[model samples]
Target chain A: MQVFASLLAGLVFGLGLIVSGMANPAKVLGFLDLAGAWDPSLAFVMGGAIAVGAIAFFIARNRLVSLLGTPMQLPTSRAIDRRLVGGSLLFGIGWGIAGFCPGPGLVALGMGEVKALVFVVAMLAGMGLWVLFEARAGVSK
Target chain B: MTIAWSTFTPWSALAGGVLIGIAAGMFVLFNGRIAGISGILGGLLKPAKGDAAWRIAFIGGLLIAPLVYALMATLPMPQIDAGYGALILAGLLVGIGTSYGSGCTSGHGVCGLSRLSPRSLVATAMFMAAGFVTVFVIRHLINA
Candidate 1:
């Protein structure tokens, strides 16, 4: 049931990305191009998502288990440390360069974009490197 | 910044966002999970017992989304201006950063902000700010 829900969630999420103009790197770049002709559409996308998500989260917080009886697994970390800040900065720089974050990258890949193949493969490799480096650092997640 | 009125799609963007939120809502409400793309993909990197199945299932759905969309209507095309070098560089950064940062746009930007997580708030601001600065450098300073 959870697996089915996840698949459904992913499908809907990808459709939303398509519908929201988020799957379009040029449009995403338009939002980030603050010095250029900026598109304010992405802001509305985030706002609309948050408006509905906030309500769902509010209800989620009060629940002990999910509707499918799975354990709630929201993030537990609150530390605004170097990894969080630094990693995000790096990610942002990358996003600005290519306008492909993880989600859109995957969505584009699903659409069979060769460019997205490069991004996704490199992303996986980067994650692999993190695993290797973090393992050496005696950290595991 | 001048408003790009031509491409400003407030209505469609909002509707799509609602669909995304609904998807997220369903995940948390039914499955007790956050629909964060990077985190889910990251988990697949080091598959754990009894955990890898759903992650694969989720990603599989993502991988097949385009075909589904094509069946409904004419698929929209997204422009990719970056070359191979830039694409690879960006991908590596996104992979490492999302792993180290513990989330990406979907996880931290959408779900995290929705849950009012302070950590996500900071992460979101950091990425957005960095995105703004990077774009500034590339477009204005580098004169790309």
Candidate 2:
């Protein structure tokens, strides 16, 4: 049941990206192009999502287990360290360049975009490198 | 900056955002998880036992979303303007960065903000500022 619900959530999320024009890299770039003619639709998307999500999270704060009786696995880390800032900055640069974050990249790949395939493969390779780095550095992931 | 009034779409964006929120909300409420795309995908790399099914299933559903949308209406065209080299570079950056940060837009941007997490707030702010500066340099400074 949890797995099924996860799938449903993924579908809903993907549809949202499609409907919000977020699945389009060109559109995403338009939002990021702050110095240019800016399309502010992405802000609205963020606003709407946060409004609903905030309430859900507020309710989740008091709950110990989920409806399906699984323990909530919300993140517990609160450290505002170099990794967080540095990684996000790097991610942001990548986003600004291609306007394709992980979610949209996957959505495009699913749509059979060759460009997306290239991007996804490279992204995966990058991720693999991280795993290698962490293992060599004796860092617990 | 001039507002791209001709292209701005507030209503659809809001509607779509609400759907995204609901999906994320449902995952937390019933499934006890965050619907963070990068974290979900990245977790696959480690191949932990009993942890791979839901992630794969969720991604499967995401991949099938286009087919479902196509059944209802014509699929919207995604205009990706980045060249191959740029795309590859961007992909690598995104992959490494999100891993280091431990979240992406969905994780830190959407769900993190929703949780009112101070760490998430900082991450979001950093990423947004970086994005702004990067775009300014690429489109305005470098090309200008």
Candidate 3:
């Protein structure tokens, strides 16, 4: 049941990505290009998403367990440290450069975009590197 | 700063965003998970016991949705202006960065902000600022 719900949610999310024009790198780049031909459409997308999400989160906060009876695994970290800022900066730079975040990147790859494949492969490699470093550092998660 | 009003589709964007929000909302409500693509995909790298099924199912849904959309209308072909080298580098940075930051646009920008998380707020601001600066440098200064 949990798996089915997740699948349904993913389907809806992917449809939203496509319908919102976020799956297009050009559209994403247009949004980020504030100094050039700025597209404010993405802002609306964010606004709409947050509006609904806020309400849902409020409801979730009142609940002890999820609908499927699983314990909520919401993030509890509150510290704003160097890792957060630095990692975000790096991610932002990458986003600005390629105009492809993880969701849209995967959506593109699912559509059989060759460049998307390359990006996904490279991304996996990068993630692998993180795991390697984490092991060496003995970071117990 | 020229606003591209001609190309903007506010209505569809908002509608689509609502759909995304619903999906995310349902995801957390039902599955007890954040609808973050990077976190979802990243977990598969080192899968825990009994954890791989839903992740794969979710990703399969993502992969299949576009194909379903193609049946009704022509799907938009992604137009990436960056070269392969830039794309690869960008992908690597995003992967490493998201892992370190513990979230991405979906996780931090949408879900975290919705929950009024202070750390997420800071992370969101930093990423947005960084994105703006990176674009500025690339488009104007570096001329790349």
Candidate 4:
């Protein structure tokens, strides 16, 4: 059941990307080109995302447990530190330039786009680097 | 007639983002895990006590989603300007960054922020900053 839902959700996500024009790197790049002819589509995308999330969160907040048969693992930490600022900078810059963030990058793979492949490859490497650093620092898994 | 952007009838990327948030929330609700790619992928590296199957399943689901979509929609192909070497470097940088920060955008930005986590706020900011700087460097400074 978990597997089914996850896949179904992913499909819905991919479909959304396709419908929203996010599947096209050119569209994303165009939006980033403020100096040239800036496209406001990304903003619409952002707006659409925020709207859906707001309602969904409100509804889910009342639910005590998830359908997956386990308690939701909500983050308890609220620290505002260097690590947080640094990570957001990195993510945003990457998104602005590459025109694909982690989620869209993964979904872009289905498009068989070479650029998406490059991004995913790099994304995987980024994941590997974290593991290496964590091991060296003796961060308990 | 102006189209109302609020309702999102056809459901834009914003709709997708909302679904992603909802999915992340529900994922935690039932599975007790954050919908973070790095964490899930990281778990695959160590394969700790009874924690390999779900991680694999999660990634597998991500991979399969596109193939399924191809059947129903007209999927667009991505064109990569940079070479393979540049891409490898970028990937490594992101991996290192995620590790240092403790999680990816999805975990921190989507899930964490939804829960009003200050750490996520900072992380999201950093991720954005890094992306912006990298682009500025590549496009303006380095001329890549």
Counting only residues 3 or more apart in sequence or on different chains, how many pairs clash (N, Cα, C under 3 Å) in candidate 1? 0
User: For candidate 3, lDDT tens digit of each residue in B51-133?
Assistant: 99999988887877789889988887778788899999999998999988888899999899888999888988988888888
Interface RMSD of 1: 0.8
Instruction: Give DockQ per model, in order.
Output: 0.87, 0.87, 0.84, 0.40
Q: Write the per-residue lDDT of candidate 2 for residues B1-144, one digit (tens) a residue.
A: 899999999999999899889888998999889888889998999999999999998888788877788889899979988899999999999999999999899999999999999998998898888888888899999989
Clashing residue pairs in candidate 1 (N, C-alpha, C atoms within 3 angstroms): none
Two-chain complex of model 2, DockQ on C-alpha atoms against the true structure: 0.87
Per-residue lDDT tens digits of candidate 4, residues B57-106?
66666666667767776555655555666655655556556655667656
Tens digit of lDDT per residue, candidate 3, span A6-125?
Answer: 889988888888999888888988888899889999998889899999999999988879999999989888889998999888889988889888888888899999898888888888
**Tens digits of lDDT, candidate 1, B41-91:** 999888889999899888887777778989998889889999999999999
User: Which parts of model 4 have CA positions greater than 4 angstroms off?
Assistant: A59-64, B1-11, B18-22, B29-32
- Please name the candidate that would achieve the greatest DockQ relative to the true structure: 2
Candidate 2, residue A47: how far the Cα is off, in Å: 0.6
Looking at model 1, residue A67 earns an lDDT score of 97
Worst ten-residue run, lDDT, model 3 chain A? A122-131
Runs in model 2 lying further than 4 Å from the true structure: none
Interface RMSD measured for model 2: 0.7
What is the TM-score of chain A, computed separately for every candidate? 0.98, 0.98, 0.97, 0.88
User: What TM-score does chain B get in every candidate?
Assistant: 0.96, 0.97, 0.94, 0.86
Which residue runs of candidate 1 sit more than 4 Å off their true CA positions? Answer: none
